[model samples]
Target: MDTLCFHDGNITDLIESRTLDVRYDINHNLQMHSSLIRRLSQERELEGHLGCVNAVAWNSKGSLLISGSDDTRINIWSYSSRELLHSIETGHSANIFCTKFVPETSDELVVSGAGDAEVRLFNLSRLKGRGPEENAISPSGVFQCHSKRVKKLAVEVGNPNVVWSASEDGTLRQHDFREGASCPPGGSSRQECRNVLLDLRCGAKKSLADPPKQSLALKSCDISSTRPHLLLVGGSDAFARLYDRRMLPPLSSCRKKLSPPPCVNYFCPMHLSDHGRSSLHLTHVTFSPNGEEVLLSYSGEHVYLMDVNHAGGSAMQYTSADASKVMSFAPIVNGVELQSSASSGFPSGSLKSNVAATLDKCRKLVQIAEKSLKEGTNYFHGIEACNEVLDGHGRLIGPMLMHECLCIRAALLLKRKWKNDAHMAIRDCHRARRIDSSSFRALYLLSEALSQVSSMIFIVIGYLAIYDWQHDAKMTY
Candidate 1:
C-alpha cells in the first residue's frame, strides 16, 4: 500500500467495494458510501506545488485541501475543483515535513512541523474559498519546542487547543494554543507558549553508565483515536513507546521546576536489522482508524502491521520478502510485564486480600518464566510453573492479568510447536477477550491464531497434493 504514488496535484481516495450486498452513490461525492468499500483508489488533481510536496491534509469537512512543500510554502486548494485557492510562504528557515488541519475548531487552523524544530499554526479563516492570494495569512502563533527538526504532528481530536509534536531531539512535546495566547508580553513564563514535554529516551534513569549523548532521534508519532490520550512515538532507536496522558506532568510543573523525564509505560521494539544497534530507523507509526491495529513503516523498506491488543507481539511484518509473504507470528511481552502495566489503572486497595496475593504469585511465576526463556535454563520447569499458576489461580486475577497470562502461554506453545496445545491457547485468548472486550492485545492474539491456522491449512493442502502426484506416477509406472 505504501508503494501507491500520485502525480503532482493528484489526490488518492481509498474506498472499499463489496458487490451485490452494498451500494453507494457516486453523485454524493463518495461521502455516502457503503461500509463494504475497501482500499479502492480514486484520484483527483489539484496541482499548485512547485517543489516536492512534503505534507498534505484535508480539513474536517473535506472541503479544503492543504499542502506543505520543500519550497518553504503552504498551498490551499479546493477539494472538489482542483483549483488553487491560496498560497502562503511559510517564513520558516527549513523545509516543512508535516502538517495537520486542527479539528473541533470553528476557525480553520492549520498546524505545521518543519526542519526548524518549531511548530507553527496558520489561520485559514479569511481564505476558505477560491480567491487571489490576498494579504498573506500569517501564523497565528509559533511553538519553539524541540531542539532538533520536528518530524510529525498529531492534533488532539476533540481539543482544538492542544497539539503534539514528535522530533529528532528525543522528545515528544505538546503545544497548547491557549498557553501561547495566555501569557502577557513581559511576564516571566518559561512555558508561555509550549505545553507538556515527554522524554522518549528508554531507561535513561537506570542506565547511568551509558553516554549522555546517546541518540534517541524520533521520526514519527501518532495519537490513538480510540484512546485519544494515548500517544505512540518511534524512531532511530527502533522502540515504539506508548504514553498515557494521565502519567504526564501537570502544566504548572513546566513553569516552576526542571521538567521531569517523560514516563513511557509500555514499549515494543521494531523488527529492523541492527547494524550494530545504530542503523534501524522507524519512518512512521500510526494507529488504525479504529485504533485496534498499529501500522509501522520502517525506512521505506518494511511495513509492520501489529495488533496493539496483544500488548507484546509482532503480528505481521510486510517487507520485500514476497508480494504476499506471511511471516510467523511472535508475541513480544511476557506475563509479568504485560499484566503489571495493564492492571496499573486499578487502585491497589480495590482488590481483596486473596486476589492481591494471587496477583503477586502470578507476577513471581511470570518473572521466573521470562528469565528461564531468556537464559534457556530451567525452560520446561518455567513453562510448567506458568501453567500451574494459570490453572490454580487464574480466576483470582483480573481480566488484564489473565489476558497477559494467556498471551504468554500461547507464545510458549508456538515456540514448542504443539498443535493440539495451541487450540487450548486459542481458547484462552478468546476467554481473555471475553474478560475485557476493550483489550487490544486480546484481539491481536485472536487474529494471530486465526492466521496461524490458515497457514497450517495451506501447508497441509500442499503436502496432500505432493502425495497424490507421487501416487499417480507410481501407479502409472
Candidate 2:
C-alpha cells in the first residue's frame, strides 16, 4: 500500500497473492470466507524477465504465476518453490501489455494481449516433463482482432469463454472462444473461432490536444468481481467510463433487444485542467472485490480510490498522489482475523462461529444500509446496527472486527453525501484508521471525507477574501 511500484522501472504485472480458502470444500453448509489481502509484504523477487514485465497473473488457486514481458517472452513461475518453472517465447512482434490465466478450466491455458494488436492463447499443459532447457512453447491460437496495441484483457467469471479486449485503436472488442479457434490462414488449418460479439469505439468528440490527432484510445478496462455486468474503462480520453454489460450483449441479441444503445451509463473526468482538458490518460480503472469502490490510476501522477456509489454524486476526490510508480495495485482483503480464525493454526473453540456470526450480522447491516439509500429512504436501521458494532455498550468485539464495522459505517455515511454530516463521517473514518492504520479502506474513506471538508473551507476562504478585496476597492473609490 505504501510503495506503489514493487519492482523497479514500469510494473507490467501487479497481482496480489490470492489463495482459495479450503474451508468451503471442508464444510459445504457454511459460507466460505474469501478475504482479499490488498497489500502484500514482499517475500522475495524472482528475476526472470529480461525486459519490462508487461503483465502478471496468478492461476485460479494462486499456485502459479504467469508473466509476459516486453522481451517478447512469457515466464511461468512456481509459487511454492519460488522458482521459475518455464520460460516461453511468445514470438510477438511488440511489447506484451496484458496477460491472464483462463479460469474454470482444468487445462493450463493462458491468454496474452500485446502491442501487436493480437491476443494469443497458449497451452502450457506440456510443461510437466519439460526441463528448463525445453521451455519454448508456441501459442495454440492467435487472434488478430485489434488494429492497434491491445491494452487490457478481461474475462467474465460467469462465462470465461467470453473475453474482452480494449485496444489503443479506440475500440473495445468482445471475443467468444467457445465456438472454436480461428482457422490458420493459407495452407494451414485450425478450428475457426467465433466472430466478435461487439466492437465499440468511444466516439466522444473530446480531443486531448488543441487539434485532435487521433481517435480516443482505451488504455484500461476491468469487470467488477461482484457485479459481473458492470465494466469500468479508462484511457487516453482522461475519463473513467462505467458500462453495463447487460446493455451491450452479444451481437446475436441485437435483434432481440431492438437496440437501446450500448455506449456507457456514466463517465467521470480524471484530469480537470482549469484552462483546458489535459491529455493525461486514465491508465487504469479497476473495481474492488466487493464492487463498492473503484481504484483509478492516471497517466500523469495520481491514483484515486472512490466509492462507486458516489462517482457522479460528489465533487470530492480521494487522490493518492504519487509519481510514475503508481501503476498496478493488489486487492485489499477485509477482516483478516476472520480469515485467520478459519485456519487450523487457531483452536476451534477460541473463535470461528462467534466471529463469523458477528461479521455476517455486520455484513447484512451494511447491505441493509445500501438498500435503504438506493430506495431513497432513511437508513436508521442500518445506522443503528453500525452503532451497535462500534459502541458495543455491553458487547465485546475484537479490534479487527471493530475496524471493519467502522469502515462499513464510514462508507455508508460517505454514500449519503458525507458533506451533510461531514464531521460525523470524518470522525468515524479517523477512528477506523486509529484502530487499524493498515486498513486501506478506512484510510481511503478518511481521505475522501477530508477532501470534502477541505473544499468547503477553501470555498469559504475564497468568499471572505473576495469580500475583503471589494471593501478595500470601495474605500479607495
Candidate 3:
C-alpha cells in the first residue's frame, strides 16, 4: 500500500497542523490466529486403484462415489463413511476409460467402457458388502458395437435404460438395457441391443457430394443437464460440436442417405480458431449444470469457458460456425507485459519504481485467479495461482493484496469441494478477516465454509459417540 500526504502550504505547516497516522487503523484492527492445531483440516487420496484412474461418478443422492481405473477394477465407495463398499474386477482385458452410475437405478447398477471397445455393466446389488475383490465376475450386461476404444459415456436423466457411448472408432451409440435387464423370468441378457445414434464419420461429412471417409476419434461426450436432447461430442479437433439429438437422421436411414448433422453451436478458442489447428484436440467437453454454458479442455492447453447463450450469430452458417468468445485460465509463466498498467491507477514513484512493478505483478496474478473463478471450471488451478501470489509476494505481502489473495483462495477452495476443503477455506477466511476487519466477503466466506464443516463435524462426533457407547456396553456386560 502506498500512502501520500497533501500539504496546502509547506512541510512545517503540515507538521504543525497534524501528524499523519501511518498504520494506526490497521494495527488496531489486526487479529490473531486461534493458536490451536487444525485437526479436522485434511486432504485424502483414496489409494484403492492400482493404475491411473480414468473416470468417477456420484450416485443419485451423491452418497456413493464410483471410480474406474486402468487396472480393470471399479471401486464403489460411500462418501459418508469414507470407506470402500465394493470392488469389482471387470473381466475386460483393456483399460477402463469411462464409468457412470445408471440413473434411476437407486445406485444398483454402474456402466463402464474400456479400451477394449466394450461397454459393460456392474451389478452393485449382487456384490454385497465391502468384501474382497471378486474375480472374473461376469458383467450384468454388455454392449458390443464399436470397434475401437470407448472413451466416454453419457446418461440421460430419469432414464436408466438409455446410455450413450463415444468411441475412438468414430461412433456415438445408444444402448438399451430395459428389454434384457428387466428380464421376463430367465430372459437372456443377449436381448439388449445397441443403435448407431450418431456416426461421427457420416455426420461430419460436409455435404452429400463429399464422401464420408475421413474419421475423427471421439474423446468425450455429454448430455445437457436441463435439456436431455441437447448433446455434445468432442474429439480430435479444435472445436467441440453441439447437436440436438431430435434432429439426427432416423434410425432407418442408411449410411448412404444420411445427411450431415446440423450443428447447434460450435465452441472453439480464438487461438485455435480454424481447422488448421488439428494438432490441438479437445480432451474433454461438458455442459454447465444449468445447461447455459460449456467447458472445453484441450489437450496440453488452457481450458476455455463459453456461454452458449451469448455466442455470435445464431443464424446457422455451418461452414463458418464460429463462437470464439471464450475465457481462459492460462498462467503467465514468464514476466510478460502484454499491456501497460498505466491506466490502472496504481501508484508510480519516480524515485523508486519497484512499488509499481510489484503491484502490477500481483495484480495480474490476482486477475488470472479471479478469471478462473468466474469461468467456473478448473478451480484447482485458480487456487494454485492464488498461492503463487501469496508466496511470490514474500513473507510480508501488502495488506490489500494479501486480503484479496486470501479471499480468492477461500472462494476457490470452496468451489473445488475436495476432502477437508472447507477447513482450509475457513482458515483463508480467518486470514482475510485479520487483514481487513470490516471485510464483508471474508465474513461471508467464513460462514459458507462453516456451514459445510458443521455437518461434517456432526458426522464425525456421531461416529465417535457410537464407538464410546459400544465400548461401555461391552464393559458393563
Candidate 4:
C-alpha cells in the first residue's frame, strides 16, 4: 500500500480519504499552542465534487471551520473534535463560491454565495451538533444579491454585521445585519425576509468584467482595516477599484448617511501592471491591514505590490525581479522578518532602486505630456513624449505604456465611432499576452474590448442593412 504523507512546519499527519473518522495530531505544536489553536481535516472524499478545496474560515471563537468548495457544498466542521459537524446543502445551486464566518457572533452564522445568483446566510447555531437532521444546517435566510455568480466575500473589520460580496455581475454589495430581525417565520418570501433581516444593497458602483474563457473565474477581494467604509475589489479588470461604501446609493440615501466621517480620505483607480496588450485580469486583490499598500495576483504568474498613496494618475508598478509566482500575501505586522525562498533570488535593494529610477523617468515624461496637452500644442508631440519613455525603457515600462496607449486609442475610437479600430486595439492586446500570457489584466481587458467591439459592429451592420432596404423600397415605388 502506498502511504500518503502530510507535513506542515513542525507537524506531520496522514489519513486515508476513504477510511475512518478518527482525528489525531501527529505533531505536538498545536498542543503547545492550544490557547489560540485548532485543527481539522476532511476524512471522507466527497465523490461528486470536481475541484480541490479553495478556502477555509473559522468562526469568531474558533468553534467551527466553514469550508467552501467547487463541489457546491459548505461543510461545517467542529474544531474541537475535528469531526464533520454539519453540511449546509442549499442556498447555492452551483459551485459553492465563497463562505465567510460572520465575526463577533457566538451563533454559528455562516454566509455563502454561489454561481446560481444568490447569497444565503445559515444560522448554524440553531443546528449545532445536530448531525444532518432534516432541517439542520439549512439556510435561515437568503439574499438574491447579484444577477450573476458571486465570486468573493469579505466582512468589515470593525463591524461584523457589515459584510461585502463581489460577483461576476459587475457589482459589489454590502449587507448590514444590524438593520433587521433574525430568523423570521418559515414561508416568508426570501426577498422580503432578506430585506427585513439584512439590508442588502450595492455598496459601490464600480463593476468587474468576466475573465477570459480560457482562465479561471475571478476570486479576489479584501476590506481595509485602517480605511473603514473603503472596499477593494479585484477581478478580470486587471485593475482594482476602491469605493467609499458610504457614497454608494440607497445606503448613502439612508438615514445612516449622516453617520461619522469615513477613515479613507480618498481612493484613486490604480493599475497593477503595464505589460501585455490585453488587460491583465487580476485573480486576487488585497491590502495590508494598515492600509498603507495593496497587492495583486494576476493570472500568468504576475504578482505586484503598490504603495496606494503613490498610485495616482501616473503609472505605478512593481514586479518580482526573479519572477516567481506569488500565489497570495498576508499582512506583516510587528518588526518580525518573515522571509521566503520564493523571493530569495530577487534582491529587495536592487528591485526598489530600479523601480524608483523608472518611476522618476515616467513621471518626467508624464509632466511633459501634460504640459503639451495643456498648452494646445500638437497632440502628436504629447504622444511622442510618451513614446520616448516607452522606447527607452519599453521592457520596464511596457505595461504602463500599453495601458496609456489603450486608453488614448479607446477614447479616440469611441469618439470617432470607429468600431474596427477599437476591436483591433483589443486584438492587439495580445501583444501584452506575448510579454506575460498569465496576466489576468491583459486577458480581462482583451475580453472586454472584444465584447464592446463586437456589439458596436453588430449595431452598425444592422443600421446599414435597414438603410439599404429603405432605399430599395423607395426605388421600387
Candidate 5:
C-alpha cells in the first residue's frame, strides 16, 4: 500500500487515492527522513573541477550531480554516461562554496554562492539550442547581499522561490525570488536579498573593541527536512547551534536595534563533560532526513549521532531575558535546555554558553515553576514565576510565553475552585485570546470557565453544543 505514488501537489487526490487508507502520506514522509547513513561502498569518479570541489548537490531525483569548485567553475555531470555535460564559467573570481538546483524546476534552474559574496541564478532552460554567448555566461538573476564570503545555500524542499544563505560576515539571510519573478528581464530590477534572518554581527557591533574569540563565521547550514522551522547552523565554534526561526525578531525591528540571539540550544559533547578546554569547532551539522537525529562533524574529530531530544538536553531552556527580544518561545526546542552531544548541536554547554550566560537569571525561576507544576501540590510557585516574568518584562515578554502563562494560571485557578476563580480563568482566557486569537485551548477553557459560573450556564450549554468535545478532559495547566 505504501508503494503507491500519490500526486505530489494534489493533496485532495492523494486523500481520495487507495494509499490514503494505509496512512501513505505519513509513512512516505517518515521514509524520506530516515537518518540512517549506510556505509558508502559504491564509487563513481567523474573529474572536471580544476581546483578542489567545495560543494556538490544532487537534483531532486539524485540523478545528476552539480559541482561548484575553487576554479570558479560549475559543472553538471551525468551519472550513467560518466560525462561532463556542462562546464560553465561561474564568473566568480574567488572560490565557490555552494550550488543547488532549484526544486521543482525539472533541474533546469540553478543557484550558487561563492567567496565573492554573490548569489547567482542560472536558468538552464536557456541552453535550448546552444550554450550561453562565449564568455557571456550571464546569470538569469544576481544578488549581492553578504559583505563577506557566503558559506552555504539552503533551499527548502517545498519552497523553491526562497533561498537561504549563511555568510562569513556573521549573518544568516533569506532571499525570496517570487516577487522578482514578475520583473522584466535585463532591467535594473535584479533579484537581491535584504531579509536578515539571524544577524550575529549585531551584538558584536557594540563590542568591536573587544573582539569575540570565535570568528562568528557561519560554515554550514541545513533546514530540517521534517520540521521546516528548525534551522541547524554550524560555524567556527565548538558548538553547533539549533534555532527555531520563529523565535527571531521581525526583520524591521532587528534592523532598528540589537536583537538578542535566537539560539534555542547548543549541542556540544565537550561542554557536558570536563573537556571544556578542548578546541572544538563544527565543520557541518545535519538532521537526519527524518529530522529525528542530528549528525555533527567536528573539524578534526569523530562523528557523533544524537537523538533530537537528547542532542540539546532539556536542562538549558531560555529565560525571560532572551524571551523579551522576540515574540515567542521556541516551544519545540523547550523539550531540552541542554542536550549533550559528542561534537555538535544544542543548549547551554561549555564554550558557546560562556559567550551569553548573562541570561542565566531567568532559568532558576522557570525550573521552580516546572517543579511546582509536576508535584501537583502547589500552584503558587508556578503562578509566581509567570507573574515575575509579566512584572519584570511587562510588554516586552513574548506573547507566546504570555499566552502560555495565562493558560497555566487560568487552569490552576479553575482547579482551586475558589470564589470568583472561574471568573478569573475567563479573564485569563480572554487575555490569552487577545494575544493569540486562534488558540483552541483558550477558547475551550473559556467555555469551561463559563460552565462553572451559575450566570453563564446557558452560554456554556450553547458553547458545548458547538465545540468539539475531543479535547474536553483534564486541566492542562
Candidate 6:
C-alpha cells in the first residue's frame, strides 16, 4: 500500500508499506506548499479496532510512538523505523481509553484508563530491547481510583509525579509520587488519602444517565504549563471550567469565578446538541509546547486550534469554520505561513489573528441554523452557512458546529420519512460537519422520528404496487 507522511507542514515523501518506520528531513519548499509534512508506508498490516483510536503519544525524544486502541492494547512503534517496538498488553480489562507519556522521564511510563474503572501505570524501562520478541511488562502500579471508566489523563510538564485524571464517575483526582514506594503516592495505597479535585456531576445517579454520553460525563482535561497551579476540564455540560489546585479543599467547591484561564473560553462540540449530549465525543485536550495556545480534538471529526490569550476575563474568542474532527494533530515546527486572501473566496491571511471577525461570522451562521430548525426549511442552507464560517476559522469552533450539524441533519431527514437513508445520513453528515451549535443540533434530530413514518409509507406503497400487478394479470387471463 502507498502512504503519505506529513512533517513540518509538508508532504515530503510517498512510500510503500514495506518501509514501515522511515524518517525524512522535510524542506522549506514542502512545508510552504503542503498541509501535511511527512508520510510513511508500512510493510506489516495493523488492525484497526471497532472504536476510533483515542490517543497517540511520542516518547520524550520523539523516536517512538505509542498508540492506545479501543481494543485494549497499547502498540509501541519506532517512529523512524516504523517497526513494532513492543506491545504492553495489561493496563485495563476493558477498552484502554487514553494514554500519555510522562514528561521528562528517561524510563518510559504510560498511564492508562479503561472501562474497567481502573487507571494502570506501565513501566517500559526494563523492557527496552531490539525486537518484538521482548517480553512485555505488566503494569508497575494500578490506581483503582475512578468509579467508572477513565476518559482523560495529563502529566504536569515538569512534574511527572503530579498527574491529573478525569473519569466518567464525574470526578477529577490528583496523584503524586511516593518517595520510596515503587508506585506513586495516593496510588492504591491503603494508607494514603487521595486528593479529590472536583465533582461536577452533583451526585446524579449513574443509572439515570447513559455511559456514552460524554457531554454529561467529564469528557476531557489538561493542565496549564505556564500556571501549573491551574487545571482545565470539559464535559457533557456545554462549558469547560477552570479550577485552582492551590485551594485548601480541592473538591469542596470551585471558586464562583476566577477569570477563566486561556484555554477555558471557547465553546465545545458538547455544547452544541440539545439531547443534553455532545454530538462529538471529545477525545483529547492539550496545551501547545509554548503554552500560548490550546488544542482540542473530538469524535465529531473536528479539531480546534485557538489562541489562549484571547480568552479575556469574560469574553471568549472562537472560530468554527475551518477545523474538522481530526484524528490527530502535531504542530508544524517549520513551515511557511499558508496564506489566504479575499480573492480566493476565503478571508485573507491567517484567521488565527482575528477572533472577533471570526466569531461574528460563526454567530451569523448559528442564527441561520436556529431559524432553519424552527421553520423546517433550507436545512442544508443552514448547514452550508455554518460550513462557510468553519472554513474560515475552523481551528476555534469547527468541532462544535460539525457535530451539531450532524444531529440537526439527522433530525431533518427523519422528519421527511427517509428512515434508512436518515440513519445512514446522520452518521455520514455528523462525520463531515464539525462545529458547535449551542445544543440545538440534538434537538433538531426530529429527523429520526420522521424517518420511522417514512418507512411505513414505503411499506404501504410496496403493497399497492404488488396488488395492482396481480389485478392486471387476472384481467388479461
- lDDT string, candidate 4, 293-322, tens digits: 787676664565667666432324322221
Per-residue lDDT over 267-372 for candidate 5, one digit per residue giving the tens place of the 0 to 100 score: 5442222123234556788888888777888766666666666424222222223323222322223333132212222233443342232123334444555566
Q: In model 3, state the lDDT of residue 238.
A: 69
* TM-score for each predicted model, relative to the true structure: 0.53, 0.53, 0.56, 0.45, 0.52, 0.51
Q: Which ranges of candidate 3 are over 4 A from the true structure?
A: 1-42, 134-136, 179-194, 202-213, 252-259, 312-477
**TM-score: the better of candidates 3 and 4:** 3
Model 5 earns a TM-score of 0.52
Q: Give per-residue CA lDDT, model 6, range 19-136, as digits (tens).
A: 2224532343344433432244455754534456777777667887777877787777776766777766664678887788877776377777777767777778867654565646
Worst 10 residues of 3 by lDDT: 1-10
Residue 82 of candidate 1: its Cα lDDT?
Answer: 75
Better of 3 and 6 by TM-score: 3
Q: Candidate 4 overall Cα lDDT vs. reference? A: 0.52
Runs of candidate 2 with Cα error greater than 4 angstroms are: 1-41, 183-202, 205-214, 249-264, 267-275, 310-477
Worst 10 residues of 1 by lDDT: 1-10
> What is the TM-score (0 to 1) of candidate 4?
0.45
Pick by TM-score: which candidate is best?
Answer: 3
How does candidate 6 fare on TM-score?
A: 0.51
The segments of candidate 5 whose C-alpha lies over 4 angstroms from its true place after superposition are 1-42, 131-136, 181-193, 202-215, 252-257, 271-279, 311-477
TM-score, candidate 1, is 0.53
lDDT per residue, candidate 2, 1-477, as tens digits? 012221111111111101122332322211221112334478998999889987888877789998889998888888999999888888789999998887776537778889988888888887779976687787877777466898999876656586788887666767677655543421123423334344334233342222223456778888887888888877775546677877765543111213223444333432232113345567888887778877777765456667776533232222223212222223335733222221123224544564455455555555665566567566554565666545431133455666666676776676666334454676676556555547688778878877876777688679879999999999999
| Pairwise TM-score winner, candidates 2 and 3 | 3
How many residue pairs collide in each prediction? 10, 7, 0, 18, 20, 52
The whole-model C-alpha lDDT of candidate 3 against the native structure comes to 0.69
The collision pairs in model 2 are: 12-54, 13-56, 36-333, 38-331, 38-332, 181-191, 181-193
